[model samples]
Target: MSTVTTPKATTRKPPTRFEIRADIPAPGTPEGAYFHYTPAEAAEWLPFSVYKLLKMANARQIPYVDNGKRITFSGMNIRAISEQFTVEPFTKPARAAA
Candidate 1:
């Protein structure tokens, strides 16, 4: 009979917070700085579904950075996208004079 042995698997610790870098300069806005966001993080900030965010990226409607294997969005880019969908509150019309 032959003896067999298996190695134990190692677990990784989850990060407490996402990494946000400010050194990178945002495109178009030279004086402004922005942070990068993972796809999931972008979704949370946009308050939209991840699926929709990915779709927008794929369609080239939103700007993103492709770091070989993963994609990231700049804070400035997200803000610009959000502004397009902003809605104003509605108010009732004034009553007509007698």
Candidate 2:
């Protein structure tokens, strides 16, 4: 089985505590980053195998929410996870024949 390498641990600052009406969003700022997505939903872009995602979730490799029946990932986290695994194309010129 392939192993997943999670991002390096970092000191995450505690989330700022505040009281705001969730029904109303701040101006110019969208409040749609908190949506959760199923592994199948993320597969559209992540293109990762659903089985792998579930295995990772089961092994606590990736962020997930298993509500005793279904497993889902927050949209923000899913996107971030996908970005972290993206491999940029090689841009440097090939080496000359030695």
Candidate 3:
């Protein structure tokens, strides 16, 4: 059996930060604009669980056509719902005069 040698650059430290996005336009969005995200993509964007999303969809009965139980949502629809359902921040009320 032959012995393998390690490369000289093995001691070098790798860069800490990495860029993951690409220049490709989103599938459902306009070119050179914001990228469109699918349901799975939306799942990645937010911190909610798939089960939670499903429950929300079921509760609200969001309009979506099914292809043999395979449901699909448009990027536009997801964006609209996300914006509509988001909770706005509230400021504390001023104290009443004593």
Provide the TM-score for each candidate, comma-separated: 0.52, 0.50, 0.43
Q: Which candidate gets the maximum TM-score versus the true structure?
A: 1
With a 3 Å backbone cut-off (N, CA, C), the pairs that clash in candidate 2 are: none
Identify the candidate with maximal lDDT.
Answer: 1
Instruction: Score residue 74 of candidate 1 by CA lDDT.
Output: 72
Clash count list over all predictions:
0, 0, 0
lDDT value, residue 29 of candidate 2: 32
Which residue pairs of candidate 3 clash? none
lDDT of 1 by residue, 1-98 (tens): 99898998998743222444445444336443366666666666676777787788888888776566466777776777777678989999999999
What lDDT tens digits, residue by residue, belong to model 2 across residues 1-98?
99999999899742221212234322223453565556665554465777787778788877766665567666665766677788999899999999
Residue pairs with clashing backbones, model 1: none
lDDT of 3 at 43: 51
lDDT per model, in order?
Answer: 0.65, 0.60, 0.49
Candidate 3 runs further than 4 Å off: 1-28, 31-39, 61-65, 89-98
If ranked by lDDT, best first, what sequence of candidates would result?
1, 2, 3
